[model samples]
Target: MQPVQAPVLGPQVDYRSLVVVLLSPLAFALVFASWTIFAVLGVELKRVLLFGEVQFAVLLAMPMLTGALAALPMALLARRVGGRRVMIGSLLLICPLLWAIAYSDVYLEFLLAGAGLGLGAGSLAAGLVYVASLCPRRHAGLALGLYGAGMLGAGLTYFLLPLVSQAYGWPMAPKLFLLPVLLVALLLWIFAEDAPRMPHAPLDSLAEPDGARSESPSWYWLPPPAVCRLALYYSFFYGAFVALALWLPGYLAAQYALPLKQAALWALAFTLPVGIGQIVGGALADRRDFRDLRWWVSACVMVCLFLLSYPDFTMQIHGVHGDIALRFSMPLGGFTALLAVMGMAMGIGKGSLMCLLYRDHGDDMARSGGLALALGGLFAAVLPLMFVLGNEWIGIRTAGFMFLYAALAVCMLLMLWDGARTRSSPLTRHSSQPPSQAD
Candidate 1:
């Protein structure tokens, strides 16, 4: 790779770039909030429709599945047309869909309209490209983190839906988003630029001969292997985050028998920390290599997962004196605390991993970011079903935690192997330098 260089800046550049960074993630947060609308709404939909558990689960997963599939293509479109345009287009696309969802009473109609929320995945990809291009190397992690913290938008739905539905009814809940979505889309159009030459290959690579660069369209869109490695790390953390965000309201409701609105409120414990921790992780990533921090974050999450994986059980012992019985169950307070810690750890993992992505793979930001988001979406989609099946097949409520623990173990082992391989490499040595010194 060509040596990193400092970007030339004008007085106006900083102000403009600042606008892009601030404005873009606001757009992202709104998109993200809208993306998971079904999470809160599904509870009511179930009662009204009288749908089975599996059908409810499918309805929950459909947007994530479609979003995962759409992320890459939308990212590719962003690459050609521009991040600003795609993000604006994505925001606009969501408005009609929200209307469709609010008006629909049928299960099939609501399900399909809900699927349109996947456009937010595209919003994420394109917005990341626009924001990362303007961030200086010294503050890339912090910039990315701030952008990521927009995920707090999910909380808007969590906190808002209960009040909206309670007052106006469930159908009016989705309609509430229509004005804000349009407002954000309009702001993006007025303030955000296309970032004409965002992240792409080095100047040297751009100078390659036409003959040398010739390749199939399929080959051209593929991200490099190094990027895929980073995506693997991100997918697990982000996927779990998304899955739990969707699953938790329901999980809390069923496991504790809490009312749906109350359960949604409680789940803010997990979702809020995840957003805050991303800012923490991204700032740290900007200052140093993330490998060591990644290990610590993973270890913390694993410990929590280990605790969470245990199901309620009773034990009996036969003794000469008498019979002894022991019983154990997870307390709601303790479970919420564990969820908060794990969410923070996962958020840190996500923040740092994304920083690392921009650090190394910004040159192909669209494809690489798309690939990671897509994988995360697929993982999120699979997890709800797994939660359902695990409960049925294994007859353990904590089975979802068990599955996550296993997946995280595999990720950690792979990271360790990769770390050992890179330890002695020149690139690793160079990357260890401080951003200012390295540049």
Candidate 2:
């Protein structure tokens, strides 16, 4: 049996929803940029505060910590009252935090402000649910891809903040976001549409793909907790992409001896590709099931990580002529290429996985998207600290990549086992096949 498609909607609805989807990324991008504020701004702050690597990691991750904590509740709230209200309120909520960060000098003050950036995460949760609710199935991947591309806004600070900080000063940088955030919030308040909430129902993965016009069901309707499975898989791609996006400028500068702005620019090789790949992933996902696609995405990411994890090495050998020394390291170009490819793979995986989530849980995106983002946020929060710890314990600058490699390998293995077990189950076969074919 084929998957069910979304019911056809009138052209007016189609046009309105498309408009909402097109503009939705602005809101998502604003929240995402806010969520990742520390990535670039912290470079200057780190210099002023004279914090240790560990403390810097903490500062870098604090927003993610709070964001993860906030995602689910915001999602639940959106479910009851509708995503539009939650999203609008969430967008407006970050204004004070930005103002506070601009004025504060203390690390605690900054951290407290950073914690409020969790509202940015909640906004993302609301925004994702909103888009999922309105987007039709035929273009589901593209819709999610556009929403995911809001991560590109993280690059806005990466590219522009340093310039803003250089001229007006670091304090002035956060203020730049104030206008755009307000504008997006206002637009969403006026124009966004959310799927009407239905009576609470059990998890149903077999729900129709067209989310907005469908008889949308309640949260996590899939049996055996498919939402959790989707969340877990997406967490790796999203978590790693976000962690690296936040951590890479620092790593590039430290490892390559580049200036801060220069390093941030180079890190865009990673982030820009990740953003664009979301579109690619979404487009591809529209054509087929993404379970198989994710295997390729995961495998590509692993291969890239395997290469990236190897540190620069110097080798010596005694020869008849004389002692010979050979030095090997990833050149800037090679490293950037690999990073871009890895980012692409991660982006594609994220886009496809989100689409998969919608295919299974589109009717329940408020809960599903919230849980997924929450897990990704928590996972992202842990990665930088792990990178710091891995370096201290292992004494390799590339230790972060190594840790990611190992983590991915473990997940792949576990998923492989799970897939094998599921395939072997008679009940799984019976449930998967249509009634006409089950016999």
Candidate 3:
């Protein structure tokens, strides 16, 4: 067979590449919608199965754990074979698994089927690599930002799944997901083109002369410290975003005594901003210093978490004549407004973090982005358990916000420490870029 030709990189925009970039996010949205179906269904399942708080948390977390574990291998496969093929195959494979989930009668059966459906989440790893290959280096931030908007599918599920379940039945929810998954997969198969692969080279030998590195980095290169930092930030921002997406419908219903449909709508107060903020954040990262942007975003999130950390409190005062009582609590509208702001902050952080990852590891984005996402997903998985434990131990619904507050506090402290250290260095003063950029 003849060798595959290199992709032409012209000065003008490549409309073919742009089309692929646009389509990749739409495909991702469908897969993501399917992957997160459990979030909406879990609330109903809790009632049907008579599951306790911890068990419900486990049920919610299972798919995230499985999805995180699958990310690295799926990304490597995308790199080796082709992103388009991996994406199409993943979408096709998850359809039957979703059907199985819909048909599952026992809790154990549902858990097993949900694990299989988790593969749908791995589409992000492949989609990232696929979109990155099509866009120029300068545009990678915007491209990834646009692709990241596929997360809006999580919001879409929040809006639509409850309605679907109400209209058809809980079992029919996953079955509805089947239609879009197949449609997106077929469109991708017909229209999407995989990026051309470069010849094999030693991992360390691919470094650029000025140390900027090419678009395709080696798979075996050790991740820099920045990767871990970004992962932590992402875990709090993107991971927490995922956790809340799963948690919020139930949260609103329990906390405010809202109907399921109303609760889902309230959840959108958080989810919609996160989706739109990513696009705005991506555009900002392209023009501004990502380091500065990330710091500001983290600071804002820290404050929001602080406000959100408060649980309902009541105090009674004894007077000469009688007794007086006072209560302090955030109203639902106030709480939702805080979540909206927090979502925007997370969205900006998500966009900036991806930009940093692509800038530093563009060549190996499949691995690096996948690993980052995996780590973030792990946090998403664990936090739900923490939320349950916090609630059970503390006997307060808002206990989860305390956990988030602590996490964001740690992130803020680390950022400040890193910032102070960087400021003291003369070289860092000259260029505020990450040490990996020096490579």
Candidate 4:
């Protein structure tokens, strides 16, 4: 059997690469923090607007909708003009909208402001493209993972916004975020540099041999099949992460009957682990094959989701003379622990998926990453509405977990089928290619 070759690390590291890695995540964190401002603020908005469950869900979903819509366009523009331009332009455009959200007195106004704020979320695709351009190929996974760890910004919002709102009112939270947004914008303008351009083949030409030519298809066409599959994978891992980050505060308040502040704290417990786990996941992907890492993580998360899907259950048994009662429910502490475990697994899966994309589509990272993020964000936007509908229609508070569990089960089955097909292929016997390459 042929041994797998180790990834080649470039002989020298670029200091500019270090700068991009350090600042990009920090900038992304600030953008994410602003993008997710609605999660915490929506609680206050619900009270102010006197909105019903569905209405509030829509309110929380508005930014995600806009983010999803903008992701692909922003990514394409970044690829053409430069990531720095896209990132800076996006940050600048959202600042006014955030300020408007702070002062919005009515529901429509807040919705409009939120739609504008959605542009902030598009920064993820731009940041991914930008960081990939700067870093060495061997280190792309770790670099993207570190940048992705900026998701901790959501945790920061969960932890800090409630406290600030308590002191200065919820309106002040958006205003406070403006400071960081502006600061990051200035830093990016001063320090950020566009990476040297790498030559790329058309996505359609990827299957052809070296020096082969194919028709250059229209730029606006649908993504390739591999991109769609990766997007589906991302929709479950990162998309679910986005949905839960926004939904958890409300879910905790409703399900566990906790106050807003306490609910935010509990939600933070889940968000922090997911954010930190990305780094570990990325590092693992750099050293090992991402396919194996993703499969193991997905399997573990499926178990946790299965366990979490059960609503508080109670049973009555009739005995010879008397009645016996049985009750089964996960306590709050235990539920939070399970969520933490799931978050860790998701964090790893997110990193591994990004690594896999870079490895397979290195030439078209911008377009592929952008489309994947757009689909994931679209899924994130839709899940909140589903959560509200599930609760109302089924009368089960844990319905959201049930939905997630079913989706993950389907994803796992597809992975298994793909694995089987690979092993059965004639190429598998003769080629020493990595499992990821075979896929």
- Estimate TM-scores for all models: 0.91, 0.90, 0.89, 0.91
Each model's number of backbone clashes? 0, 5, 4, 0
Q: Which ten residues in a row have the lowest lDDT in candidate 3?
A: 2-11
Give me the overall lDDT of model 3: 0.79
How much lDDT does candidate 4 score?
0.81
| Candidate closer to the true structure by TM-score (higher is better), 3 or 4 | 4
Ranking of models by lDDT: 1, 2, 4, 3
Model 1 CA deviation exceeding 4 Å by range: 1-13, 198-207, 423-439
Worst 10 residues of 2 by lDDT: 4-13
- lDDT tens per residue, model 1, 147-168: 8888888788889998899898
What residue runs in model 4 are displaced by over 4 Å at the alpha carbon? 1-12, 202-214, 217-221, 427-439
CA RMSD (A), model 3: 5.6
For model 2, the superposed segments whose C-alpha errors exceed 4 Å read 1-13, 199-224, 319-322, 431-439
* Model 2 local distance difference test score: 0.82
The count of backbone overlaps in candidate 4 is 0
Task: Tell me the whole-model lDDT of each prediction, alpha carbons only.
Answer: 0.83, 0.82, 0.79, 0.81
After best superposition, candidate 1 residue 237: deviation in angstroms? Answer: 0.7
For model 3 the TM-score comes to 0.89
Q: What's the alpha carbon RMSD for model 2? A: 4.8
Off by over 4 Å in 3: 1-12, 199-221, 318-323, 423-439
